[model samples]
Target: MPQRPLARALTALVAVLTAAVGAVAVPGAAQAAAAVNYVALGDSYSSGVGAGPYDLSTCLRSEKSYAPLWAAANRVTSFKFPACGGAVTSDVIDSQVSALSIGTTLVTITIGGNDAGFADVITSCRFGSTSSCTDAVNEAKAFATGELPGRLDRTYAAIRDRAPNARLIVLGYPRLFETGSCGLLAMSTYKRTILNEAADLLASVTAGRAAAAGATFADTRPYFAGHGVCAAAPWIRDVSGVIEAYHPNADGYRYGYLPALTAVTG
Candidate 1:
């Protein structure tokens, strides 16, 4: 062979060998390096009701929501966000799962809150009497313990079926209130304790469902410990005129949920 041609061919062969060796050394390195097709599915928290500027009037999808924040920061090739303001698990199975596919590399969900009637509890407790508050809390606790696990399991299964290859991360709700009053005139200290425990229960049940479905669970309670509605620097709104009340704010998504997603997905 001519020397120049032979030398060029040798260099090309060496490059190919190096590429093959790299792929072999780090299994799934090529797949991992591929851009992630992410789909966000769930309810108010995922839709960014409290964390607005919203994308749609109904869906309430926010660019500042933790999923979008994570997607923007990461190598996301495509994104489909179907999370709405009051979506239950059934809503996800019917409406949002269509967004998922085998091509999806990641799916993050924050449902089951609406299914357990969490919003109704907040509303009834905030405006009604102490007895009404207790009743609402008790009802929510019942739903969380009895019905939520089954609902969650179904949602997880649906997502799994739609995106078998994707990594699912089930994010849970945070405790909405702190111990002391901190000028929250709605509920008493006793009520606060009950509500907080209910939130904890929701997280626990959701975590169990996620584990059963082979999905990762992100517990958000710790992230909002000192940043509850009554905290000095509250991440959740106490009672906003807009739809922002009780949900996480822009800062909450940035500081709280963002880190949790990053830690697990990375």
Candidate 2:
């Protein structure tokens, strides 16, 4: 009952063709499922100012930042971290967007705080009288509600233009202080409340602008809720002598911002 020679030859040819087809198809499928090409861009928060042991000291790009953590965890194809310590909306439009391109499949940014004069506002609140602190907060709030929206619009638009295929994520700053006693910290409860309000306002404006630009907004407030600067297990730094003051610590990037980002990306 052995097969004829011609029949056996034809069957062997069919097997070879099937193997060749599978070889071609398998690689294509793998390419399609490959990891993303990610680019991280923005200001101090994005660059990991509060998280130490920076990989790029010029920009304060930390290996512990959410960007790097996510990149490593997900095993992305490429990761470009151009985020600096003090980038404003203008800086993103002018310099940071250069890192993006059609190949960039993911992008994350945290900006607008510097443009709102947040650092100066914090300085005023920390050192000046209650009236001065209130005035500073009011001024920053005005700018955030007024001129900051347009700037954010421009920044988001520029990013989209550069990385047309990227899923852009706009991350927000967390409320810096918890409204209570930190034994030696001089900030009043009123100051803490106003500052938190300012952060909320900034988040709202940034969220609205991000929606308009077709980008996703990731709010860090909820994640950092009980972990503000004065909390028992705080994630944000509390008036440290260095530039890291009022920013997220390493844990903040890992547990707070990282989780917020993961939720949105999923």
Candidate 3:
């Protein structure tokens, strides 16, 4: 894939300039036609880590990432995709400030997965016995219950301060559980339980936090609900798409984020 462009920042210069006194302007003397300035800020799930047709080398950014997909679908004019792999909530606080320019109309974030260390949970579930899966669920919940809110608060505050005017949308994690039905892999009962628990944690934490922030939180779990391990039309089919055990698939870009597009743009 082509070298990733410097993550674009939203800028409202046109609005500022046009409003200034004694500014000579176009004949229409009209407000500038503001195209949606969208910035996607988050981690691997947001970056489409394993969901690639494999194009870019650096940052391992996926071309099929929801950001590009949404942009094309909506005819978005300005877009910045800074989402990379391994982003924690703290990373969101650090990088998202300058990511927006001036006319930023929309922002979508998918983060907090790494904080849960979901990959390790999967490994423990896959390699260990039923008891290990129970341990994983508890450990995962500890993050969601104990740490997710704090991380979410910081992330929300940072985004709000950085792009106060944009319509921010927080996304929940996708359902990656395989409860004895995935044709791809006979995911152990423990493994499925852990995966579902992780998804639940992410959803509850993000949904509550985003609501507090007055941002839209799109819950994708429902979209993928019936399609879990036992369902025939599973939302996410790729194993590694689990990103060590429970993230979305390239199909997730379709299943998981389209609703986000509708919500944010609406």
Candidate whose lDDT is highest: 2
Off by over 4 Å in 3: 1-33, 54-58, 178-185, 229-231, 237-245
Greater-TM-score candidate between 1 and 3: 1
Which residue pairs collide in model 1, if any?
A: none
Model 3 C-alpha lDDT per residue in residues 79-192, reported as the tens digit of each score: 888887788888777765579755787899888877887767767776677788778778888888888888888888888878888888887777776575455446666568
lDDT, candidate 1, 109-174, per-residue tens: 999988988888988878888899899989988888898889888889999999999999999888
TM-score against native, each model: 0.88, 0.88, 0.79
Give lDDT per model, in order.
0.88, 0.92, 0.73
> Candidate 2, residues 169-215: lDDT per residue as tens digits?
99999999898887765588888999999999999999999999999
Instruction: List, in order, the clash count of every candidate structure.
Output: 0, 0, 11
Worst 10 residues of 1 by lDDT: 181-190
lDDT for 114 in candidate 3 is 78
TM-score of 2: 0.88
Regarding lDDT, does 2 or 3 come out ahead? 2
For candidate 2, list the clashing residue pairs, or say none. Answer: none
